[model samples]
Target: MDEFLEKVFEAAFKRESEQDENIVRSLPFFVAALGLVLAIFSQVVVRMPPVGTIASAFLYVLFGSATAIFSNILWCLFQLVRARDFKLPPNEERLLEWADSLQKFHKTGKRTRKAAEELAIVDVRRRLVEAYAEAAVDNRKSNRHKFKYRAQGFMGLVLLMVLASASVGVIFFDKTWRISHGQGATAEAAFPPPHREKRIDRTVRDGEAQASGAGSAD
Candidate 1:
């Protein structure tokens, strides 16, 4: 019975370790996703039309808003990858001490060989159960936190992708507007064109008047 219980405890501990390893393995994939999104976002921004009109202004604000949201999501992913404390097996030295104590107790004529063996198994089993319980509880909590963060990161990435696609659409629309308008739209286009004074040639007018006067005198 003790041996069977020990096996069960060992299995539980193995499961917790595997869970931790799985989370660690998933980190690289998340990082790669973030990098990909960042690259695409850069392209979108670089190709965005200049921000002089109402549409371009709205696009700038949308990009800024998307960036802020994405940053929060990135922080969540960072938290998921950050180091956390995990419980390990009972110390070997401590287990050895318990075994030695059991031997000493047996040598004092307090127990027969069979009884000593049974007691040793019972003591070891008790220690294993305690360690397994503590580790299982602590690891479960850690795993829950990791799972929560992982879910948040995943959802955040999805939202970011949607926003990025929308931004691309807006950029395309802006480009189309610029193309159809001859690319000469200015911020001041909202106002009328500037007025200029029409200049007159006073010297030419004065020479014409003098020639007419001399012809009349002749």
Candidate 2:
């Protein structure tokens, strides 16, 4: 019975330790998601011009939504990584208490020393079991909280990516609409092409002047 109890506490401790390591390993993925959010915001939102027809107006709405989603994602990732009450190994105070109990058991009279040693051992085991149980419960709670935030952040990242793609499509659609409607002609009209007639006249005048100057030299 005692051996089984020990195994249970040991398993709980090991499981929580593994969970803590996993949370650390998963942090890089959260950071990568953050970078993706920034990349999409800059490429699809910040650089896009404000001038457009209906598509541009729709894109503006998407940009606003994306911005808000990314902000929330940032908050979620921050919560996931932020420091919290993670129960570590048994502290010095507990270890010293165990040692003091053992010393008292040894100092007892020789007749009771053997029994005292057994009781001390059981006491130490009980303390260890309590520590493991407490740490496991608290650490599991912390892990659950972190995982929840991470899940939220990951979903937000997926949504932002979709919005970015949609925004790109909207931009392309607006450009196509402008071209089909000849809305881009205004810029061409504003900067009219140079006169070919004026160029030809200048060329002729230069040729005549060059011929006259060469003839005089001859």
Against the true structure, what is every candidate's RMSD? 11.2, 7.3
Question: What would the per-residue lDDT of candidate 1 be over residues 1-218, giving only the tens digit for each residue?
Answer: 76776788778888988987887788887778778878878988666565576666877777787778788877877777788888987799999888878867876786778888777778878888878878887898998888888888888788778777777888788767767887736522433233311123456678899999999999
Instruction: Tell me the TM-score of model 1.
Output: 0.76
**For candidate 2, what is the lDDT?**
0.76
Query: 120-200, model 2: which lDDT tens digit per residue?
Result: 777777777787788888889988888888888889888988898888787677657767989757633443335755677
Q: How many backbone clashes does candidate 2 have?
A: 0
- Looking at model 1, the pairs that clash are none
Query: Whole-model lDDT for model 1 versus the true structure?
Result: 0.76
- lDDT (CA) for every model shown? 0.76, 0.76
The total number of steric clashes, by the backbone 3 Å criterion, in model 1 comes to 0
